[model samples]
Structure formats: structure tokens, C-alpha cells
Target: MGHRGFKSSQTQRGLAMVELVITLPLLLLLLFTFGEFGRMLFQYNSLMQASRDAGRFVAGQAWNATLGKVDLSATLQSQTKSVAVYGIPANPNGYPAVVPGLTTGNVSVAAVGTDHVQVSITYTFVPVIGSALPAFYGQSVPLGLALTSTVVMRAL
Candidate 1:
């Protein structure tokens, strides 16, 4: 009876090892998924804040008291795009974008309903693995996710 118990213990140890081996990959995948989700959320939050900042900046400057409306002048729109992309009114030399791959082209500023200014930012989120997955059976898989943030504030 004692001998049989020792044999079962050894088999149990082997079973545990096999179980770990089988589940390890799944566990790792789950962990990476969670980390990626957190990163995505963080990037989204940054975009939201940047849009808010740009909206605030534009709302304060876009109002034309004489015109009695929000002005979407070219200069004002350009500056708002700069603020959305670079956190500044001007895009300085050698200054990095607020978000990776973010560009002035991706930001748009417009007058909304004659009284409000709107700032919109669109960005693509690239995963840590890469922007696209390796082709499987000649079909390419894209992994980039698009995120957009828009804010409207009363022109000051």
C-alpha cells in the first residue's frame, strides 16, 4: 500500500507539470491582452485630454465680438491643430507629436452652430506586436485600431 501511494505521488507531480505546460500559453496571452487593453485606454485618455485642451484654446480665441459668431479662420484652425498635435500654439522644430503618428492632418477645427468651437482628433493605435499581423494563407490581417476624440466648447 505504501509503495502504491509513492507511485501515485510521482504521477501527480508529472500531472501538475503537464497541466502547467498546457495552460502557460493561455495565461501569457491573457496577461498580454490585459496590458494591451490598459495601454489602449491610456492612449485614449491622452487623446481626450488633448482634444479638450485644443477645444479650450480655440473657444477662447475663435470668438469674434464684432462678427458676433465663432470664427473658423485659417490661422485659428492651424493653431488649434498645432495645439492638438503638439500641445502648443506653434509646432516648434524638433518637437515630437503629443501622440505617436499624430499629425495636423488628423486634427480638424470648425465652428459649430455659430456659437461653439469643435476640435476633433483621430489617431490609430498600433499594438505592441505590430500594426498588422503576418499574412496567413495569403490573407493580411490588420491590427490597427482607430480612436477619435471630439470636444465642443462655447466660444469665449
Candidate 2:
């Protein structure tokens, strides 16, 4: 017997509700964290693939059989940057970047060791939560993390 001559089950009717109220927020937070982590990984994978594609493009174009070395010309560099961002040698109008906030300036193409071509891409990942977080010290913390992907391929 419990309050008002009712059984214990009746008195504990709201117990589950109280527990759920307490734990729901934590569960939702964990779910969102996992989702954001997955999104970040997806973006990083896209960046890496773009870098590899650009590296392959440059490697194929920079190799000179007669010179026996890699020659990265200005036009080739521009096209490589375009390829990293748009997956093509030419940037078509209204084409979206491979990853959000990616641009031609973020891509760099270089000749490595005179025999290899290196394509590097730098991107700043902005979380879905916010671009910046408030710190305890009254300063704003940047949530955007810089991610760099580099691919080197032998010129041929």
C-alpha cells in the first residue's frame, strides 16, 4: 500500500517519466555528436579523394619523356587547383566545390623531388553546432579545424 490507499505501482507511475526527462538530453547530445563526427569524416574523405584526383591529373600532365623530369607549368598549376575544387580542369560557372568552403586558393600543386607531383589541399571544417565556441576565459574559441590532405604520385 502507498499514498492515498493506492498500490506502490500507482505511486511510482511518474518514475519512468522523471528518468526519461533526465536522460533524454544526454542521449540526444550523444546522437548529435556521432552525427557530426560522421559528417566530418565524410568531408575529409571527399577532400582526400579530390587531392588524389588532382595529383593523378598533374602527374600525367607534368611528366615529359624527353626531359625525363616533371615540369609543372603555371597553366598546369591553375588547372590542378581547379581540378581539386571542381574535379575538372576547367571551373564551370555555378559549380559547387567538392567540400564546403573549398577554393582554388586552398589547393597547391608542386613538383616533388623532380620526379613526383604533389597535390595538397587545405580546408577548414566548420561544425554544425557553430563556427566558434565560448570559452570560460571570456575568449572565443574557433571550432573550425584545419584539415590538410596531400597526395604524391610518381610522374609518368
Candidate 3:
């Protein structure tokens, strides 16, 4: 008589080890990519916050006729290590030697009236991980990530 009991062959089997081997690399790659993106986003946010702080400080100041040119850039440069004022011909690349992990670009400050001052901070963001993608040639990778921020405020 034929076997009347359930047969292992008839039951659906779980994923094979080979299947896991094939997908594990892809999963790990996706995880690493996501982590790198998160880090980049955090750095971008920090940069924006720094810019806002500097702009606000400048804007809240009382207008002084004795002050010829408000050196907001110098004030900001002293406040943080990652902030600097650009426009030095020696550093034409806009990379501020004083600031670490930040390259300062053009900064424009204009008096929008008698009681308002506009401050804009422009900077170049260099990705930590994306910049190294070129070393892994023949592998698919993302590179060349950059961002900028601007802030405006009113004088007190």
C-alpha cells in the first residue's frame, strides 16, 4: 500500500541557505547607504543651525553710527570652529583654513532699511562617505553631495 502519512517532499520548504547568501549582501548594502544618508542629513542640519545663529546675532544688534562695517563674520568665526568668513584671495577655493570640516563661501550682509539687516551665509558641504566612493571602482556608488543655507533677520 502507498504511504498514507504526510510526506516531507509534499510540504513547502523554507528559504534555502543559498537564497540568504544571495540576498544578504544586497541587504547590507542598502543598510549602509541609509546610514550614510542619515549622517549627511545630520551634518547639513548642524550647518544650517550655525548659520541661523550667526545671522540672528548680527540682526539683533542695535544700529551704531560709529560702527563703520559690522564685522559679523569675525564675530561668528570666534563663536565656532566650523564657521568662517570667506573672500580671501589667498584662499581662492573658498576653503577657510581656520574652520575644520567646513569650507566657507560668499557671505553678503546688507542693511535692508534703518532697522533690518540681511545676512546670508553660503558654504560648501563635502560628504564624508560619498567622497570615497571613487576608491571602490567597478562597484555602484553615489558621490558628489553638496548643500547650502541662507538666513535673514531683522535688527532690534
Q: Highest TM-score, which number?
A: 2
Per-residue lDDT tens digits for candidate 2, residues 110-148, read 888979999999999999989998988977999998889
Give the residue spans of candidate 2 off by over 4 A: 1-7
Ten-residue region with minimum lDDT total, candidate 2: 1-10
Which run of 10 residues does model 3 get worst, by summed lDDT? 80-89
* Candidate with the greatest lDDT versus the true structure: 2
* Model 1 weakest lDDT span, ten residues long: 1-10
Better TM-score candidate (2, 3): 2
Which of 2 and 3 is the better model by lDDT?
2
Residue ranges of candidate 1 with Cα displaced over 4 Å:
1-7
Inter-residue clash pairs, candidate 1: none
Per-residue lDDT of candidate 3, residues 20-70 (tens digit): 889999999899878878876776676567666656656655355566434
Per-residue C-alpha lDDT of model 1 across residues 3-109, encoded as one tens digit per residue: 65356554576787899999999999999999999999998999999999999999999889999998788998999999898999986685888888899999999
Clashes of 2: 0
What's the count of clashing pairs in each model shown? 0, 0, 0
Which pairs, if any, clash in model 2? none
Q: Which candidate, 1 or 2, would have the higher TM-score against the true structure?
A: 2
